[model samples]
Target: MNKNFIIKKNREGKKEDVPKKIFFKTNLFYKEKGFLKFFIYSPIVKEYAFYTLFPNGLNLFIYDKNTYNKYTYLRADWVKSIDKMFFHIKGNIIIMSHKGVSLKTEEIFWDRRKKKIFNKKYTKIIFHSKKMILYAINGIEASEDLKKIRLKNINGTFPVK
Candidate 1:
């Protein structure tokens, strides 16, 4: 058998590779207690035994807990769900908030439980309201809503009012 196969025991006591489930142009929505929490759209998605992979690209939209309004938007060239509460996002990652704040990075890790996104890579943050741009060489930690942010080794420019 090929090494890439996910071997499993068949009914006949024979080893077989577990079939992978794949979908194209997929849209998934999550809800909690009848309230819509978030939505995920992917050009292509693959389901393995332990993880879900988005090979092409994915867009995520999170909704406000109370108002049910759009809170944040995330886009990435590739994404992998490490588990139920954590995801690995990579390749031209962009996160935006409804409040006109945006963040750009090559990679990041998102924690659903904490509602946080973090990375130890080059990152750029733009605040449209303040007309400022910030760059972080060492990386950044921020809330999903882009309200609270922490940047490491930061240098940036702000327009003087």
Candidate 2:
């Protein structure tokens, strides 16, 4: 519902709209929907192994540090295992991988927050909020269509600047 949170934080300057302070393992991320819908998904810890379902319906805590190629689908078995281990969270906030697509959007959301599977989406010029993680679904039922942040070696953009 707001854009202030999306402003890149200036390391040298004071950061606004962001949490007062984030610990080494603290989960931090922002979420937003079509236009006015907004929320922040803050994980309990810095475990990137946690799984996220789209549309804010599911939450999984995985610690395997496992990943697949871009645009790959999230199998039901994988989703089930993630659910079974929804508490083995670990790591430094593992983020979703686009699988391989290089596109910028403004419509990211963490859908189905009540389920064990997470769905997400991307858009352009949506709102902004402080969240530790986001789960969303943009009218899609498969994770393969979700263009997440991919790994560098997988022909995706590097997280480093």
Candidate 3:
């Protein structure tokens, strides 16, 4: 399989007929495990400074190396009201993927309230369906524990590879 993929999002809808340069300029930094070098050559840069990606479409997470603050994982499209104005996590998911990707996957989001930066406890907004709230909580615990173990191993000078 070719380890390369790119897509351009725009307000004018899909620009399927235009040249790729007119939209996005993508570079493949690592073709093996899907590391990417993405650059926007379009007009979106004139507006918002953030973008989101689904975990299935994820290359590398911007979350802290030792925390469960992957805001990207919490924005699945199936859920409702996941974003807010004062501060919220919102991103566009890959609704339709060519490969075996889930349309319900969420885009990554990390919106910090003005106070979040200076707050006593820096926190990220987590939204979930009433039924899935427990699942989300369990995920957080498991991720925190796993991160601790991974961090301990690395601290022991274990090989990263």
Candidate 4:
């Protein structure tokens, strides 16, 4: 079986196509015992990054390792639905970083962890869901307004990977 896989996500209530560049650019790095690692290229950033996927019991984790950052997700109670060409992890996803912070989201795609740099310093934003009221962020000082969902913009440098 081919090691490559395709992940599709819903955006703005519509199915968005996964960029074709992702298929050609993601090179298999390693595979062992139901685990695989690949280097996925992001056209948005015009760079290559690492992705690792491994399954443990009922949970599957996909780790994204960038030049200067590491992010991971823990998907629990995922009921698999296999089609002719693709499989899906149907459940909630917990997005985590090397820094140990995490946010949980339902039906999210590719753990939306982003890093920004300015003046030699960097910040991170772990955006999981548009409806922030449905999920929670654990770690850092987050705001609490039942009427307003809180997201954190943390100031910290990503550890060298």
Task: Using TM-score, give the best candidate's number.
Answer: 1
Tens digit per residue, CA lDDT, model 2, 1-161: 45323334577776533332333323323223422221223323211122332221123222112322222212111111133233222222223324322223232223333322232333111112221222222422323233333222122122333
Q: Candidates sorted by TM-score, descending order?
A: 1, 4, 2, 3
* Best of the two (1, 2) by lDDT: 1
**Candidate 1 Cα misplacement greater than 4 A, ranges:** 1-19
Query: Candidates ranked by lDDT, best first?
Result: 1, 4, 2, 3
Quote the positional error of residue 45 for candidate 2 in Å.
Answer: 7.5
- TM per candidate comes to 0.85, 0.20, 0.19, 0.26
Q: Each prediction's Cα lDDT score?
A: 0.88, 0.27, 0.23, 0.31
Candidate 1 residue lDDT tens string, 1-161: 55444778878999854537889999999998898888999999988767788989899988887556657899999998866688999999989988999999999998989989899999999999989999999999988688999999999998985
Measured by TM-score, how close is model 2 to the native structure? 0.20
> By summed lDDT, which 10 consecutive residues of candidate 2 come out lowest?
72-81
C-alpha-based local distance difference test score of model 3:
0.23
**Which 10 consecutive residues of model 1 have the lowest summed lDDT?**
1-10
RMSD (Cα, Å) for all candidates, in order, is 5.5, 17.7, 16.1, 15.5
**Candidate achieving higher lDDT, 1 or 4:** 1
Return the clash pairs for model 1, or none: none
- Model 4: lowest-lDDT 10 consecutive positions: 114-123
Better-scoring candidate (TM-score), 3 or 4: 4
> Regarding TM-score, does 1 or 4 come out ahead?
1
Regarding lDDT, does 2 or 3 come out ahead? 2
Tens digits of per-residue lDDT for model 3, 1-161: 32233445678877432221222222222222353322111121111223222212222222323333321222222211122222222234322111111222122222233212111111222122221111121111112112211111111112233
In terms of TM-score, how similar is model 4 to the real structure? 0.26
